[model samples]
Target chain A: MIPHDEGNGTSKPHAPRIGVVFGHPSRQYAPGEELVVRYDVEGVELPAIRAMERTVVWYTEGKGEEDLGVHRFERIDDLAGLAEALPHGTITACLPASPLSYEGVIVKIRWCVRIRLFFVAGRDFVSEHVFEIGAIAPARGVVERVQ
Target chain B: MRLPPFFGKKRGHRRTGSQAWGSFGEAVFYAALVAAGLCFAGLLLTGAVGIGPESAAPGWMRGWLWIFIWLIPGALLAFGVAGVARTVRDWGKSEERRAAAEGLGTLLESMGQSPAAQHPFPGVPACDDLVNSPGTILRYRLPIESPESWTLVGMGLFAGLWNAVLVVLAVSAGIDIASGRIEWVLLAVLVPFVLIGVTGIVIFIRRLVLTTAVGTTQLEICDHPLLPESSYDVLLAQSGSGMLRSLVLTLEIEEMASFRQGTDTRTERVIVWRDIVKEWTNLEITPGVRFETHVTVAIPAGAMHSFGSGHNAVRWRLVVRGQPERWPGFVRVFPVVVHPAPPAESAAVRHGATADGVPG
Candidate 1:
């Protein structure tokens, strides 16, 4: 998902609100495991949504420019599809083996499921839910040692 | 109760218009500079400005002054053109990105289809180039991180340019001396240029000799994109004339992080883990023949996979440190990637085991 500061516009009061919940309560997953997500939209009518995008992506966060990869993506624009996905929906995808979640001193990798609601006004609202992808230990601070 | 739009506090979530305004302002500033440069050049060309040989200055002085005076408008024109070109390029890129975003939205909405799959390893570097070059014994040859030939060429170029400048100054001084007029200032300038030129030449020659004597180190691996908990054979080839000291090969994991501090960006790298793969002491390499050795590299089961992003990386490399007799030591690095281990079930299947943990 694009960061708010980098995106083009802001969410308005009447904008649709998205709520996402993962299948696992712990929100931690192993590599090559299936990830299931359920989402619900509220505070706006289905007609206001020009399109809806669901994506499972991992992004880098820290001192560097953000890099991201989409593992799964789906778009629903038809009225019938929107009707089914508006109030409630579910998405499932088998995660890839690489780029496990990492928490480092200066670099961190995070996985999230974003449900973006694109309104007719050319603005998008992205709701992200963070999850873990691996059990790798977090990297510690720099330690000076002579070679 | 909902607050009115006018009185509502603007949350940081909204994208700011400052970037657009900044780009527009930059374009305008560069456009103005271009206009000013053109106007100045036109005035000079039309003889509106009184900078010409018509003045009482000497002929040679006037010629030099004319060139010096034109440099102002030349620099302005160059900077203006470059800035304008950069602005146009940036504008085109932004437009392309905007169009792509809009097009993807429209296309997906109309077709109701998913986009293409992303790269398997998002942040990892591609190993296509590394695997493309076939090795003699091993399957793949790992390219060096930084080749010594490039450094030799750079040093040679610097020495050549510096000596060229020194020769020009010496020729001018020689002409003055032959004409029975010793230009003290020219001679004074030539002295420093001569010293610097000689120093540069000496440095370049020393580096060339060292590079030749230390020779080249090549590493070849049995496979590409290694996996954890696996062992692979590696070939180390060392070629040089005289190497009497020691040669060490080590497998190291390094973490690099870059952060911008004010105007400058500083990068820091640390070797988080290292293990000595092999070491050879008191080895002599004959001329025109390479010393070859085979070693096994075993990756730790819990090793972190190679990772790379915009400004941060976790890299694995095989470093060859050679200490030569009568020459400074040199280090050559061969980068390698370690991928995450396959899933347990898949690994079991590869080992010819069924899902019930029985041999199939």
Candidate 2:
């Protein structure tokens, strides 16, 4: 049973609202700090990967901070990609709305997000992380993977 | 009872030669302090050579400046020494017991009787695709006998210092961030990050301090995202030294990827671990990586899983399966803070409990 989308509708602020200091793919949040946003005020522990699965879909209202919105954080790995994947961490998806700060998830989410091991080469050959874009794609930002 | 003049008199300690080695903790403290002293002296030597603290200070001087630098190694060496001593001591007793048991069995056999000892460290259910990555240096489960102070101190000194070193580097980087003058020498900040390794060494110490009271060994396995079901061997042994009484049993447990499991929920005992006697520790296992491992006690006919003072608290012997031979075991003990049960009302109170979060 897929869980419902958890976005705005409640009075309390969600956890911490995240913002970008001008759009830059390589830079946004600190290396270890998390990017958080919510529909309500209470701080909620963000759910994560389940069993190292390839992908997960979060349902959100896709609205700016001013308006009530819903969004999703698909295969978003790390803060930079997390912020870049969604221009403003927005996912345009609709589902039967339910409870909590997090919208309902369909499959149990993968607990650990695997990031590309950049710089040190001789790994998976691909210089870009285009493959991950589909999972973390904004309404736009979709790119092709070149070998 | 007139004895030789030396009989019960306070005697000189047993040392083959000179200088008795200091206890593990003291030795570690000395080693760290000595190393730091040398580093400081090296800096001063450069100062003597007309070099000032500004640019005159060499790279080694900066290494000694991290937080809790000496305390880390000192604590770790103490902890590690404690663990090794305990292991060695237990190792001796196990050998002795086996020898005595064998001797007894032989004597009884001559008299036409069977006085056999149970097989040492019975086998456990074999796991499928057990993984020990290159990243994992060593892994083991707690035996009936846990390692002592030096062991933990050694582990702590190493692990804590290692982690502390990293924290120091990160902090220093954060400090250096303001000026934005990080001289990255071709992917090398040239910063001596050996301290980071030092911090990791003291990780065990931090763990010891964190978990001493909460529980006797740390819940190590089954926490990693892609966790494997593992078991360690507890070698049931007898001491080789005949004079000592009280049997010393050493059970080793190692980690394995996956073990034998029932096809479905129809069977209650899903996972099983066979001991040296071939007796199995069966688990009512579940499907995923998380909840497949658990500690379940047989509830009395009318008992429910409850906890209050002593009336409701459930205390059961938890036997986690491990491949003891696969890796060396460590008993990392530390002081821990125990918390009262969460209020019944707030759902958010519990984070990582059970397969849902943490095991109660």
Candidate 3:
């Protein structure tokens, strides 16, 4: 199904029937803004999971080796209960000011909320939802931040 | 087809007489310094007091040699004293003279020989057609054929022929090794050729495939002036002749950052967001004809506007890839500028245009 047009409305579906979404409806966020990440799980019968971790990472993609800066990581509720019933949870992370999301001819910087669900099988289910993080809008002049 | 003047002209260089004269004078001055040092060394040795043996030495000849050596020292002293006096006099000059001297030094420091600025070399300017051409509002068409396109064609032919030769040689070597007719040392020699053959074959196939579908890609943004959050019609026009087995068009915004390492500057391209705007199979176009299509893409709000400077840049491009059966795929990237979203009031007016005023 075609996702909604809102930047924040974009969602990614993962293995084990998991869906991830961002709480804020827009993908574009100002620096220092709180990133609210929402996750939902379907079905309860599954292998015993070890842990669920959600990380906010800013990364580069394209033309060169990928580089990532982990901004936040928080363990979520136990995965066992989510399998018994439909599970829903949200994680809030405060964003930092740097490495503002950028796009260029040879390089692109992206900010995404990555969710990883670890299973005892040593395999992890990972999914990410990308969003834009920019500086606060200026009144008239352009904001020039050098990194 | 005639290419734009910007791309047609080749850079020309001419060595000027002044440059040659300057170099000659510098060489002469340095030679003179060397000669002076050599003369001083000879004077030092000739002026030495010892003769092989006092009895075997001619006293008159020694005396004459001493006189000549003494004259050499006198000349050196006179030159040194003159140079010191001239330097002291120059140092006592007025402020104006000092300023003039400083300005001359700066000018010489700043002077450098580089490619003449008058010629507009292709590459950046060629890719910046959208900005250079003012009338390119909705549709920006590439002017004539680019040297890059020709290069692809040439490289394809060269690689293809070379690969064929390598393949023949490799097969012969392989048969020899398989039949145990060649020495083990021959295997070692054949390994490198086989590796090169395989690499050449891949490059040859890739280049040929690209050449088969080589064409210019043009981009047309639906909105006269693109605005954020609003869906705008994105148009792609591919000009070429052939049947494409699988073709895909991708729209992406990427941010690029450049840093310097030693003397080389490297750039990194990170895709902010990308989507396959269109995909097709068995698409056919008239030979030597233009084919155009329109798709819709929303410029996500909060995305940075196009940026460029010395060290960093952000760019938006419509990338099209075409794959033909048994042929290598080719990609064409068209640069587009996403101007800052118009003011809210202006956007409203643009959207408020009468239905009749809108083009079909």
Best by DockQ: 1
Off by over 4 Å in 3: A1-147, B1-128, B131-139, B142-209, B214-216, B222-225, B239-242, B288-290, B342-360
Candidate 2 per-residue lDDT, tens place, A1-49, comes to 1111111112223222323221224322221133332112112222221
Deviation of model 2 at B34, angstroms: 22
Model 1: lDDT to the true structure:
0.74
TM-scores, each model vs. reference: 0.70, 0.17, 0.36
Worst 10 residues of 2 chain B by lDDT: B306-315
Residue range with the least summed lDDT across 10 consecutive positions in model 3 chain B: B7-16
DockQ score of the complex predicted as candidate 2? 0.01
TM-score of chain B of each: 0.68, 0.20, 0.44
RMSD of 2: 31.3
How much DockQ does model 1 earn? 0.28
Residue-level lDDT of model 2, residues B41-97, one tens digit each, is 455455543234575556676555433444454555566556555444443121223
Cα lDDT of model 3 by residue, B223-268, tens digit: 4334345565656676667777877887666556666657887765
Q: Comparing candidate 1 with candidate 2, which one achieves the higher DockQ? A: 1
